[model samples]
Target: MSRSRIVIVGAGFAGYRAARTLSRRFRGAAEIVLINPNDYFLYLPLLPEVSAGVLEPRRVSVSLAGTLRGVRLVLGEVDGVDLAARKLSYVDPEGASGELRYDRLVLTVGSVNKLLPIPGVAEHAHGFRGMPEALYLRDHITRQIAMAAGGEDPAESDARCTFVVVGAGYTGTEVAAHGKLFTDSLARQHRRAGSGLRGDRLPRWMLLDIAPRVLPELDERLSRTAHRVLTKRGVEVRTGTSVKEATNEGVLLDDGEFVPTHSLIWCVGVRPDPLVEETGLPSDKGRLCVDEYLQVPGHPEVYACGDAAAVPDLTHPGKYTPMTGQHAVRQGKTVAQNVAASYGYGERRPYKHNDLGFTVDLGGLQAAANPFGVPLSGPLANAVMRAYHLAALPGNRVRVASDWLLDAVLPRQAVQLGLVRAWSVPLESSSPETAHAPAWSGHGYGPDGNAAEKPSQG
Candidate 1:
């Protein structure tokens, strides 16, 4: 008999872990295949450090071929799934199409940027989700500072020096925190190089969120700590405020105040990949609905985990698990075990896990963390945050650590690589895995000439 083929879609936090676990447990008993657009699995949490020039982009990217010894890696973006036929179709990077048939399938395709209906946002703002965005942002920041130094108009220089960040969640807060520091360092370098830019004309960073506090999903203490650290670092934290409209020149706040800025970063949130809904399976707010065992209710041969599946939170009755890296990592392992159990290897188990805690790196030696219910702040929290990331990274620990040490002592090299351009990473694009050209023309009007309906935040 032919060996059973198990196919996993996506190579994110959940998919990567599942592939690793299955490869080790099944050995040669079953065929394990991973389909992903990229050759490496991106470590998302430290992405801000990459944009801030603290860590090289390659340091956060781990090679899949080198790590997954026995798994077959397919380079493609899955576009269609035929559940009854047990086959899926995908298009490779070069636009070639292919198909795969599997005995068992796992969906962990992760998520895409969450876009709101605010006018001009899709055209004026860029998102920070994957490697391309990070790389583009780093160069953009450097170029802005460089341009501001040579500009003749004070108004233009001020706008170029200002950065407006939307959403104050984990990604948004970190981006704003690290961004302020990055721009500040750039300003200092320009000034030291005999540029006419003065010390008082430092970059202005504003963080806006409609929520009452930063990190609203986290504990109150953690929120307070993060707010304090951001304000201390000269970040304008505008709680209960958000953008009403965006333009090439600036953004208009909901309160009717217009703020001039050349950069508008959209770090709002994410929703499940569009592939989930395209499956036409039972779904919970765009996420495929799965049982406690991580299996589709009517499809025993199919399993789902991570951001793509709405798995029940047994710890919290009547609720689904939050879309977080912490839960995604654990669910990946549980789904792998259950998949093996379906083959009569062991007993299947329900996914049950308690909140371990949360950490927010506030740039430099300031951070906030709640580890095992113990609240920490300042350098202690920073240490905990760094240690946690180091321990969690599957590869390149030494290189990441070395980057941190070097950043601590030396001035960051600020040079624009000009690799990623403005039109490549539009905010309305559904997936970060592939770079889609801007779908809107002139302003923020989408293809239908109407703002896309906002999806529910998980």
Candidate 2:
């Protein structure tokens, strides 16, 4: 009999782990293929640090080929899958199309940004998902502050200096916190240079969420810690409020107040990749539905995990697992084992993992973390948070750690690398290039493409 071919689509938490585990379990027995746009797996949790100049972009990306030894790496985005034929079609970086025949398939394409119906949000609000968005934001923030420093019109200066971040999740909170400090440092530099810019008034940031508190999904204690830290850092936290509309000038809140600002960041949440809809599989809330064993309900040859799948939470009856990296990574391991079982290597088992805890980096020495449900805050939380990320990252730990060390010893290098355009990293795109594209696209380009829903990344 021919050797079984296994294809995993994605290089995020779940897909990467699946590839790693399967390669080890099967060794030379089975052929494994991993498909993704980038050559590396992104350590998404530390993306805010990248934007804040606390770390380099390379620190967050682990080389796929260098790390996954036994798996064949396919550098492209899977466009369509013929389940009956067991064939996967994807377009390469150079626009060439290729097909792969598989005995087993794993769908872990992950999630995309969730865009609300708010006006102008699609045009003006930016997201922080991948490195491209992070780099673009870093440049955009610096540009805004520099423009505000020397602008002749007071109103224009205020608008340029004002920033609004919607949502108070871990990503939103960290972005706002780190972003606040970055802007301040930029403004101070302009004043020191005597750039004829008003340095008396500092940049203003507002963090908004419809929920009553920040980190609504996290423990109440962690939320309170984050709230206190943000409030102390001069971030305007508006709970129970949301944007009714967003214009280039600013956003109109549900509370009948219009907040004027040139920057509006949308960190609302994420929905499963739209590609899941094309799979012809049963789905729940846009996520592919899977049995407890991480297999498609009717197709034992197919598996789905990560943000793309709706997996049952055995720990909480009547609930599906929340879309998070923690669960996705574990599910990847379980799916690999189950796939091996289909080849008569082992027995398949259900996917079940309890929440360990969460870490929220609030920039500087401030952080909110709960490891093993033990709440911690301040520098202690910061230490734990860094440790958690260093331990969780599959690769590039040394580089990331070095960056952190240098950040402590040296001043932040805040020069903008004008690479990512506003269109390239739109609110959402089904195209895979958007997911793996570079941060900078030549000169004078930004990621201002069509809009889609927001994404929730771990």
Candidate 3:
């Protein structure tokens, strides 16, 4: 008899974990097919380091085809799912379309940058969710600082020196923190190199959020620690504040302050991929609804997890799990086990795991963490953060660690390759699960000739 086919959509934390676990467990018992836009699984947490030039882009990306054994890799962006027919369709990177039939389907489609209706933000601000954005930022910042150093007008130099980051979440906070350090190094290098635009003020970084504090969702101590570290690093943390409007010239804060800047890094958050809603399935707040076992109701063969699924939180009654790395990783294993159990591999289990703790790397030896509720700061926290990342990263530990070691001993590479352009990483990327096509076309294409969603990276 022919083996059953299992199709897993996505390659982020949940999708990658599920693929790895399922590949190990099923082996020849089934055909494991992993569909992702890219052939690599991005280690998203380390993305901040990529943007800050602490780590190279490839350092955080583990090879999907290389590391995932016994899995057939399909490179494409899923555009539609026909649940009733048990078939899905997608367009490859070259505008070629294909379809696949699955005995079991797993939707770990991750998420895309959350967009707000704020005026001009869609056109002006850049998001920090993927490799393209990170790469763009690294070069953009370097070029800005370099250009500012040789600028003739002080106001233009000041504008170029100022960077406004919206949202004080982990991504935003880390960007502002590490980014401050990265620019500081560049400024020093610029001065030493001699001859250029002198008298330019130091780079000014502003981290704004509507919340009361940085990392507000984490422990109070963690929040306080991050806040203190940021303020000390000369990052202007404007809590209880937000952007009223964003323009190419600058951002207008609700507090009546106009910050002249050439850069806006949007790290507000992410919403489930729009693919979940396109299915016309029952959903909760844009995520596909799934039971504790990660199976879609009335669709036993279909499973959903990660940021794309609204999995009930057994620990908290009547509530759904928050989209976090901790929950997604666990849910991936649970989904695999439950899928296997459905085929009589083992007993099914519910998804349950409390957050082990939270760690925020504040660049250099500064960090804030409350692992298992033990609050730690300074070098100790940084050590914990680094160790956790090393262990969590699926591959390339030595390379990442070496980067860290060399960064401490050597100056960061302050050059941009001009690889990713603005058109490549538009703020309104179509779907997080889809690898970006040069030109968005085929099915799921917006009337404007792009994917209905936007392109994203990690």
Best by lDDT: 1
The lDDT values for all models are 0.90, 0.86, 0.87
In order of TM-score, best first, we have 1, 3, 2
Q: Model 2 residue 31 lDDT?
A: 92
Q: Please provide, for model 2 over 85-140, each residue's C-alpha lDDT reduced to its tens digit, 9 standing for 90 to 100.
A: 99989988888999999899999999888877777777678787777788878878
Better of 1 and 3 by TM-score: 1
- Error (Å) of candidate 3 at residue 289 is 0.7
Backbone clashes, candidate 3: 13
lDDT of 1 by residue, 266-302 (tens): 9999988989999999999889999999999999999
Candidate 1 lDDT score relative to the true structure: 0.90
lDDT for position 105 in model 3:
98
Question: Tens digits of per-residue lDDT for model 3 on 140-183?
Answer: 89888888888788888888889989999888989999999999
TM-score for each candidate, following the candidate numbering: 0.95, 0.94, 0.94
Q: What does the lDDT read for residue 353 in candidate 3?
A: 81
